[model samples]
Target: MSTISAQAALLPTFSEVQKAHRRSDVLILDRHGELIHELRVDKTGRRLEWTKLKDVSPALVKAVLQSEDRRFYEHGGVDWKAVGAALIDRFFGSKTRGASTISMQVAVMVQRGGRPLGHKTFRQKWDQMAAARELEKSWKKDEILEAYLNLVSFRSELQGIAAASRGLFGKEPSGLDLKESCTLAALIRSPNALPAVVGQRAALLAQSLSPGEPGEAYRRTAIDALSRPYRLRPYLALAPQVAKILTAGAGQGELSAQTINSTLDLRLQRFALQSLRQQLDLLQGRHVGNGAVLVVDNATGNILAYVGNSGDSQVDGIVAKRQAGSTLKPFLYGLALEKRLLTTASVLDDTPLHISTERGIYMPHDYDHRPRGPVTVRTALSASLNIPAVRTQLLVGTEPFADRLRRVGFDLRRSAEFYGFSLALGTADVSLKELVNAYRCIARGGIVSPLHLTPGHSGRTLRAMDPKVAYLVSDILSDPGSRSVTFGLDNPLTTRYWTAVKTGTSKDMRDNWCIGFSRRYTVGVWVGNLSGDPMWNVSGVSGAAPVWLEVMNYLHGNVRSAPPPRPRGVVAARVPAGHGEAERGELFLAGTEPPSVPAARPAGEAWHIARIAYPPDGTIIVIDPDIPEPNQRVFFETENEAPGLKWRLNGELLPPGEEGRRWAPRVGRYELALVDNGGKVQDAVSFEVRGQNQ
Candidate 1:
C-alpha cells in the first residue's frame, strides 16, 4: 500500500452534515408559490445549505469529475497516479495539473470550513488525503460528492452548488444541462477566471464530451445569461418582522424555517404599491416623501398587502406609531353607545367650548372653524367634528374611553391620564396596523382579530365591543349624506359600493390618513413625510383617500360592499322631527329606544311637569370662590308648581314655595327633595358641589 493511503485510514468519519443541512436564506413565497422575497442571511453568518446527492444533476456530477478528478470512483481516497504525475512535474519545473481527488477536496472543504485552495504545501495535501481515506470507510461516494459541492466556493461571497446555480444561472442544480454543467465545472477550478477564458474551456469540454452537438460554435451561454439583471419582488421591508415569527416557535427550534408562506399576493402587492407611488409622484413638489398602504381581509384577518413605505423611507410606516387624529372618533362614539350614554340619534353640541385643565383652559373647535348647531351623534361622527368629539369624550369620561381604545387593540402605551381630553382629538399615537385592526373590529361585528401575515396562523378573536353598537357606528360612517357636511357628496370617499370610511388630518398636517373597510376587506392608507414635516394644504381626502379609493376600486372590481345584516337586539325606530336632520332610519338597542312622547301636551287643568329643572340631576356644579356668597347661590326651579309642595335640602325640611328660590352652594353633596302635604317625597336629586372654582 502507498504511504499516503496508510495515513488516511487514521482519521474519523462525518455523516451528520448531510442530515443537518439548512439554507441560510429564508425564502418568502406568495399564495401561488411564486418567490416574493428572500432573507439572504440567517443568524449563523454562513450561507451554507445541504443539498442531497440524489437531487443533483448527473450531468453536472460527471462534468465535475471529468474536470477535477477523473478515476474518482476507481481510487479508494488519494489518487496516487495523479499525485505521482504532479510530483514528477514539479521536480522537472513544469506547470502542474490537478492531482487531488473529489474525496480529498471534500475533506478539506468540510474540515477546514471552506478555506480557499489558493496555494497549499505538500503537508496540507497529505493531511487532506488522510481525511479523505477515513471519510471513504464510512461514507458513500455520493455523500462525499454532495458535501464537496455544497461546501466549495464558486465565486466571491458565493458558496455552495445551490447558491452558484441560483446566482449564476438563476436555476437549481437539478436543472443544469450538459453545456451548463461544463460551465459550472470550469468555474470550480477558477471561479474568478475571466469570462472569455471560462467560456472557451467550457465550450471545448462540452464539445469533447458531445461531439455530435454543436457546442464548439456556441457562445458563452452561462456568462451571457448571468450578465442579465435579475429582478425580485421588493418585499424586504417586511422580512425582519416575518422572520421573527417563523423561526422560533413552540415546536420549531430557532431558525427552523426554510420558507415563509405569506398571505400576501404578489400581484396585488405590485398593484397597491403602484397606486401609492402614482399618488406620491404628484405630491412630490409638496415634499410628501413617504406613504404606506395596508389591506386586510375582514373575514379572516389576513393581511393581503402590507407596503411599509412607498418613497424609499427606511422607517416602516405600517407599524410606525403616529398621532391618530380624528380617525379615533368611531371608537369613541361606539363606546358612548355601548355605555348607553348616547345613541345614533342623540344630540351633541358642536359649538366651541372651553374645558378647564390643570395646565390651562382647553378649547376645541371644528376643523372648518364653523359651529354645527345641535348635530346628532351620527352627523357629528360622520363629519368628524372636533368640538362634538371632545364633547362626546366628556360624556364618556376620558380615562374610560382611553381604556376602551386599548382593549380594542390600539397600543396607547400610556395611561389615559397622560392623554386626557385631547385623546378625543386623537392625540394618542398608533400604528397603521393597530388602527386598521381596530376598524376591522367594527367590520367583523366588534370582534378584534389580529392581522395574520403568514398563512395557517389563526389568531384569537375577542369581542371588543357590542356588535349592535358597532353596526350603528358603521351605518353612520357609511352614510354619504352625513359626511357630505364636510367631505361633500362627490368626494373620493363616496364609492359606488357601500363602504364605511373616515378621513383624518393630524394637527399641523404632519399626517393624513384614510381608514375604512368594506364587507370583505379593510384598507388603510397614510400619506405624509416620514420625517414628520408638515404637508402643504393637504388634508386626508386629498392625501390618502385617493390612494385608498384606487385600491378599493381594484379590490371590488367585480364584487360589491353590501351592507351587513342587522344583528339581533337592534331595533329600527323613527327619530322625532325637529332633530338635527330627519333620521332616514334610526337604529337603537331594543330596550334602549327613546320613549314615545306626544307632540303636544294634554289640554286642560294646567298640566304639571315633573322633575327638577335647575341644577340638573348629576350636574357637577363648580363653586366660584371669587364671587360673593349671595351671587354664588344656585337657583332651584321646577317645571310646574303643585299644591302643598315643600322643599328639603339633604333630608332637612325647608320653607314651601322653593320655586325660584336660591340656595348657597357648598363643597359637599346636597340631596334636594320636594314633598307633598303627606310628607311623601315627590321629587329628589343628589348632586355634588366640589372643587374651588378656578
Candidate 2:
C-alpha cells in the first residue's frame, strides 16, 4: 500500500515489454526510406528512434524507470495510487499532475504530440488508461519506450531523438554526453525554456539526477549515452503556407493525428530558411525581422514549403498574417481577366483617384505616391500599380471580386474591414498560407488544393478557378515586368524560364513582398514584423525579392524550364494617342480623368496602338518554315504567315487564324492574341511590322 517504488508496479513482464516495444517502436524512414527523423512523438514528446535502442546505452531506460515510476513493471497503464493522487491534485491542488505509465505517456507523447494531459471526465480518462493497460498487457516495455521517444517533441519540429539530437544539440541521440543526457531529460519537461536559463527548473532536474558521485553519475550517464550514438540526419520541412488548409491539416477537430503527406522538400526548406535569415542579417538597422514564405508545385497544387512569419521566438513557422500589400494584385488582375472585365492589353490611369464609398471617401496612389497615366493591364500588373488595380477591381465589382478570390482559396470575410481600395493593395489580414494558395490558383492554371494533414483528401482534387483564366493570369504574372515600361531591348524575352513575378509594399513600409512562378513551381515571400511597424522602405522588390529569387533559383536549378502557356481572347487595334475619344485622348491626356475605353463599336472603326510599332511586354511567338513574303510586299518571307481570329503582329491585325491549329508566322515574334467571340464588329490581332528573329 505504501508504494514508494512507483515505477516498480508499472513494469511489464519481459515478454510484455518485448511486445510493447515492437508495437510502440516505429522506424521513421525518409522519403527515400533512409532513416532520418525518427520519433515516438505521441506521449511525453521524447524523441527516440526504435531501431538503435537495443544497441545504444540502456542505462537511460533504467534511469527513466527508476526516476519517474519505480512500479512501472507491476501495474497496468496506470497505478491506482498515482491516479488517485492525480485526481486528488485536480480537486485540491493548484496544478494537476499526469498519472500515466511509460506506455500511456508514450502513447500521449508519440501519438498526441503536445496537448493538455487530462481528460474531460473520469470515465474517459479511465477508458483510455484501460486501453493502454490492455495494450501493455499484451506488449512489451521497450515498445512503450519506442513510442515515447518517437512522439516527444525535442524543442522545434524534432519529434524523435534522432531529429532532436541532430536539430538541437547537433549530434545523434546515441552521442549524448552525461551532461547532455541530463540536459535532454530535463528538457522533456520544458523544451522551450532551457533549464540552464530557467534557474528553478534546472535546479529541479539537476536535483532529480542526484547522480550520487560528485562527477561519476554524470560520467556514467554520458558514457552510456555514447554507447550507440545516432547517425541519421533530421527532417526540417519549410511547410507550405496554406493557412486555412494547413490549419485544418493540423486538425482543430482533435489532436489525434493522421498521416498527412506534405509538399515540403526538406532540403529546399532548410535552404530557404538559411537564405531568408542571411538576408535579414544584412538589412538596415540590423532590423530586418519577421517574415513568412510559401512554395508550391504549381502543376500539382502541392505546397512545398510553408515558412510562416518567423521571428526571434519559436518561429511558429507556419501561421502569421501580415498585410500582403501589392502581393494581392495578381488576384485582382486575375479576377478582372476572368470576369471578362479587362484584358492584358486594356489601359488604365495609374494616377491617384478619390472615391466616396458608403464608409468614407477613399483616395489611392502608388508606393512612391507618384502618378502614372494610361498604363496597360500588363504594365499595371508588372509595376504593381495601386490605382489601376483598384479601378480594375471596381470594374470587376468588389463583392464579385472578393467572392472570386474566396472561391480561389482566399478568405476575405475574415478581414473585410481591412479591404476596400487599399485591399486591392493587400490591406487584408492574411497569413502566408492564404496568399500562397490564392496565388497558386494562378500558377496552377486555376486549380486549388486546400492543405490536408490527415490521410483524408489525399491527392483529392478541389477546383477553385477557371483553368483558361488561370492560365492567362499566370502568363501576366510570369513577366514580373508586365511590359508596361519601355526599355532598350534587343528582343522580347521568352519566359527564359516560364516565370511570372510581382512585388508588393505595405503601408508605413512595414512589409515587402514578392510572389512568382516558374513552369514547375510557385514561390511567395513576405518580409515584415509582428508589431506592424515599418520596415523602412523594404518594398517587395528590394526586401523580399532577393530571398525569393534565391529560393527560386535553387528550386529551378537543373530542371527543364517551359514557357508559360499562351493566353487567348485578346485582339489588336489602331488609333492615335490623344486622337480617339476612348483610351485617354488629349482631354484626359492633358490632365483629367481619361475617357474610358469605349465599348467595342462596329469594326473598321480604328483603334491603334495609338503609338506605332512598340515592343509590348509578354509577347510570345511560334516560328514557322519560310514562306513567300506578302506577295512581294517588300520581298516578303517565303517563311510564315500569321493566322488567328485575333493574333497581333506588333499591334497590327493578323488574318483570321484557326484554332487547335498551329500558325506559321512571317519569321518573327508575334504577340499571342485573341478575339472576343462575344460581339464587336471585328477584333483581330494586328500583323507584326518589326520583323525580328526573336
Candidate 3:
C-alpha cells in the first residue's frame, strides 16, 4: 500500500475549509425568540447542514467510525491495510471492500461534483487520497468527524447527520438512540433501501458490532427503529412566508442555514389557523375552498397572527383584492356624521328607492328585499340597510366619500365617478390588509397607520376621520338593539364583551368579510373561493362572522372591549316626547342640532300647519323599469302629523285628512304639495321621476 507524500500534498487554509463546510439553513423564530421553522437547504438545492462537533452526538460519531473506518482516529486518510486488501481482492476478482476514511469522505463531499465511491481514474483516486490526508492534517479529529457526518448523504433526500436524524429518526442528532445510530450508520451505504431491507442490514450491523453476545434483540430493535416513518414539526405552512421575509427585496442573499426571528406567536398562529381550517372543513361541502385571517395589535399595529390560507389554494387572500361589501358602510356613515349632514336620531326613509347615473339605472335593495320605513340613522347603519346608506351617501356626496376612503388607507385607484352611487354599497375592490388597517383606523380613534410586522417598526399616522364621529359609529355598531333588525339578538357578531363589528358580502356572495376590533386587538377574516365562484347559500354573518368571533374571543380572552370615551365635540341630547319619536337619546355634533323643533303646536291654530317631508325640494328620484310598478312608490309625508292634513299631486286632490300618501310614480316631472283644511299651501316641492332599463 502506497502512502500520499506530505510534502506534495496541498492543504486548504482554515478559512477556506470553514467556507467549504458552510451550509444553508434558515430558522424562523416567534416573537419570544423561540424557533418556529427552519430552512435546511441552500439555493442550489444542496442539503448542507453545518453542525458543530459539540452539538453533534458522540454516539453518531462513533457509529459512523465503526461503520466506515474503524481506525479513523489513527489513519491520516488512507487505510493501507484495507486498501491493500481491496487491491488484492480486485486482482483475485473478488468484491472490493471500502478503505475510504471519514476524512476522505469529507474531502469528496467538499470537492465539486465529488461523491462517495463514484467512478474515478487512478490519478483522481490518488488526488482524493492526497486531499483527504491534507484535510486530516488541517482539521482535528472531532472537526473531521463532525464535517464527515454533516457532509455525507445518508438516504434518499437525506444529507448530513442532522438531516438523517430528523428525516429518518424524527429527532435532532443529539437525541439519536443506539438503535437509531446503528440504523443511520448502516444507511450510509444504501440510503434508498426498502424499510425491510434497511432493517435487516441495520440488524446485521448491530450484531456485528457486538459479535460475542446474543444480539438478536438489539438487531430487531434497530431494524424496527429504522422502519418507522419520519416525522417533523408541522411548520411547512409557514415556510413560504419565512422565505419571503428573508430573501425578498433588501434581504436578497444566498440561501444558507439562517435563523429569523418572526413576529408570529406560535400559539395564536396555531389557534387562528385551526379556527380557519375548522371553518373551511365544516363548509367544504358548500365548495368553500379558501380562507385567511389577520390579527393586529390595536396599540402597536403589530400583526399578532396571520393565516394566509386554510386550504391548498395558492392564492393569498390577505393581499388579494376583492369587493368590499357593506364593510365600507361604517366609514360612509362616519363621514356623513362627521360632516354633520345627519345626526344619530335623524330619520331616513328606507322604503324602495331608485337612482339614475351615467352607468345605468341604479336600484339598491336590502339583503331581504324588505323595506324598513323611517328608521333612525343609528338603526339604519347598524342593520346595514341599503336605502338609508344610499340616502346618507347622497347627503355626503360620492366624491367626498371616496376621498374619505382614500384618506383612511383604502386604495381607491379610480375616481369617484368610476364607482358612482354603487360606491356607497362597496362595489370597489380592496384587499384584506387595507380593509383591516382601515378598521384599525377607527379602533385607534380615527387615525390611519400601517400595521407593523416586526418589532421596532415605525409607521406614519394620519387623522382619517373625526374622533367623535368614530366614537359614535363605534357606539352604534356595538348596540345590539340597532343590529337586532337584521342579525338578530344573538349572532356571531354579538360578543360577550363590547366589539364593534361589521359584516359584508360581495355581489352573489363571492366574498364574505367580518372585521372588528376589541379594546386591544383588531382581527379581520375573509372566507371565500379564490376562484371567485359564488358561495352556496353563504352570508357574511354565517361565512366570516363566526370565524371573526372565534378569533376575537380568543384574543380578548376574558376581557371586554369597553366603550370608548366620548370625544370633546360630541354631545348627547335628549329629544323631547313631542319633537322626537320615542323621546330617545341621540348623539350629535355639539353645534349641529335640529332647528325650530317645537315641543308641541297650538291646537286649532291656522299657523299649526304641515309641510311636505319626503321629496324635500328638488329631489330627483329615478324609477327602475326592472322594478315592477306595484313595487315602486313615491312617498309623501307631512312635517307634522296634523289630523286635517291633505295631499295633492299635480293639482289633483287626494283623500282629505291624509297626513301621508304613497304615489305610484310614472315617468314624469310632478309638483307635490301639502295643504291643510284651511286651503293654505304649507309646503310645495317639484321633483322628477326618470326611468331607464339596462
Judging by TM-score against the true structure, name the best candidate.
3
Q: Give Cα distance to truth, residue 284, candidate 3, Å.
A: 4.8
Tens-digit lDDT string for candidate 3 (357-404)? 877788899999999788888789888998889988899999999999
Which sections of candidate 2 miss by over 4 Å?
Answer: 1-16, 22-47, 50-54, 57-261, 284-286, 315-318, 358-360, 414-418, 453-464, 480-496, 567-694
| After superposition, candidate 3 runs with Cα above 4 Å error | 1-25, 38-43, 46-63, 76-78, 83-98, 107-139, 169-183, 186-253, 281-287, 558-560, 577-581, 595-694
The C-alpha TM-scores of every prediction are 0.70, 0.55, 0.74
lDDT (tens digit, per residue) of candidate 2 on 173-286: 666654555545545556565333423333344456563335444444433433334343424223323223433423222333322344455676667778887788777563
lDDT: which candidate is best? Answer: 1
Look at candidate 1 and give me any clashing residue pairs.
Answer: 8-130
Better of 1 and 2 by lDDT: 1
Candidate 3 weakest lDDT stretch, 10 residues: 599-608
| RMSD (CA, Å), each prediction | 20.1, 13.8, 16.3
> In candidate 1, what residue range of length 10 has the lowest lDDT sum?
598-607
